[model samples]
Target chain A: MIKVQQEDFDVSAELAALAAGNHGIGGIVSFVGLVRDLVGPDNAEPALRAMTLEHYPAMTEKKLGDIEAQANARWPLEASLIIHRYGRLEPGAQIVLVACAAAHRQDAFDSCNFLMDWLKTEAPFWKLEETEAGEDWVDSRASDDAAAARWQAKPDRAAE
Target chain B: MKILYFAWLRQRIGVAAEEFDLPADVTTIDDLVGYLTAKGPGYAKGFAEPQVIRAAVNYEYVPFDHKLSNNDEVAFFPPVTGG
Candidate 1:
């Protein structure tokens, strides 16, 4: 499970579905990324009014599927879900959600981190935020690259 | 043919999508980038540093050496930045 949508999702409902199938599973880890009110120039204190997210439609889904496949290969996840939104979103809006269910806490935690890291660095999505200052396009952050690099260097996984 | 730009590529190219005829020798991503560079200053700047740029054809990520054909959708952009 990978979904890219434009509507807000119910995190609790998604977690329930992810957790329902595995009676043996002992842990479920979920991550929800929210749109922040502040982005861009620090001194200017930009108030993000809306965000428009663009993606390579067919390619985006494929890349996300690949990420899930990799996680499945590494861990014993009973189920997983990834939901991402597009179009204009307001501050405090949920942008993405990732949930992992595994037999142990370690697998769930590691898989969730791995998915989020890969998505941040490799997923094809562009964000444009309309702020008080003006419309500012978000840049690929160096920090995100570092986060992804950590997983890319995992001895068990091939280089991405 | 459709030409698509995403992320910083859209910022540099000044548009999300555009259309153009397939040029005679433009059969690879590199050739297309060169052709785009010749279009104007913005294009040249957009592709100023080609090493940092990546491309995809018809929604599949491909290297600069990837071959292309008529009516294909070609995209140019910086490394993906998403989460």
Candidate 2:
């Protein structure tokens, strides 16, 4: 399942939905991303006020579906999900969620990580951060690009 | 054809989208950029840094040299920063 919306979601409820009706699923891995109050990840001061997320509405859902499909193709995933929220959000608010379920814990973990990596770079969403100084669009991080690049090296599954 | 802008590109361009009857000489995404840049100052400023601008034709990302059709809906923005 993939969802793109402006409203906040119940994390527990969403995970339960993904895990339901799958008796074979032995383990599940889920990740949630939240907004930080600091401009830099390592910064101690909280200069950031809010973040407004923008996306191409027509393309956002389709791209997320494509990412989920790619993760399923590469792993033995029984079920997966992606939920992303847009609009202005305050610090500590949830922004995104990704979960993968499989018979093994490793598959669940690996696929969950893989889903987020792809979403960070490939998804058609951008963030504009508001700070005490002013508002500015966030720049793409090189480390994030490198994170997504590493997964391209060894594809676990071949084309059918 | 329709050309859409988002994020700062939309802010700078001063419009979310625009319509154009593409000329025969404008064949690729870059060519379309060249055509629009000739329109006025807002467009010129919006597209001043071509390297940072990302594009999609029909909602799928493509190279600047990707071919275009008169019916295509092209969008321009910046690199994604979503989780």
Candidate 3:
């Protein structure tokens, strides 16, 4: 499953739904991303007041579906779920969620990580952080590209 | 063809979307960027750093060298920061 919405979601409820009747699944791994109240250097005070997420509606869904599909193709997963939020969100608000289930713990864990890594670099959403200083569009981090790069290096493993 | 801009690119360019006739010689994303850059200062500033600007052809991410065709919806924006 995949969703891009402005409303917040209940992670527990979502997880329950994903594993409800799946008797074969033995493990589930999940990740949740949250907005931070602070920005800039770590020592800097909390300056981030809110963040606004913008996306190409049709394109966002399409790209997310592609990422989810890749995860399924790469793992022996029973189920997967992705929920990302948009619009103006305050600090500490939930921004995204990713969950995966499989017959073993390894597949669930690995696939969840893979899904997040790809989504960070490939998803179409853009974020604008608002602070006391001013609003600024967030830049893509080189670290994210590096993380996504590791996946490309081992295509054979990913296919297995 | 339709061109769309997002985030700071949209704000800088001063428009969300626009319709343009793809010139016969504009065969790729690079060619389209060159044509738009010649339009005015707004476009020039928005695309000041072509390296940081990303393009999507018909909603799929593509490089500047990607081919173009009539009636395609092309979008240009900064690198993605979503999770």
The DockQ figures for the candidates are: 0.64, 0.87, 0.88
Evaluation by TM-score, superior candidate among 1 and 3: 3
C-alpha RMSD values across all candidates: 3.2, 2.2, 1.7
iRMSD, per candidate, in listed order: 1.7, 0.6, 0.7
Ranking by TM-score: 3, 2, 1
Q: Can you write out model 3's per-residue Cα lDDT over B1-83, one digit (the tens) per residue?
A: 99999999999999999997899889999999999999899999999999999999988999889999987999999999998
Query: Please, what are the lDDT tens digits per residue for candidate 3 over residues A28-119?
Result: 99999999877566757548889999998878999999999988988889999999999999999999999999999988988898899999
**Residue A122, model 1: Cα distance from true site in angstroms:** 1.2
Mark the regions of model 3 whose C-alpha exceeds 4 Å error after superposition: A39-46, A155-160
lDDT of 2 by residue, A1-160 (tens): 9999899999899888988999999999999999977757677555889999999988888889999998998889999999999999999999999999999998899899989999999899999999888899989998998899988886653332
Q: Residue B76 lDDT in model 1?
A: 84
Judging by DockQ, tell me the better candidate of 1 and 2: 2
Against the reference, the lDDT scores of all candidates come to 0.86, 0.91, 0.92
Clashing residue pairs, backbone N/CA/C < 3 A, model 1: none
Q: Pick the candidate with the highest TM-score.
A: 3
Best by DockQ: 3
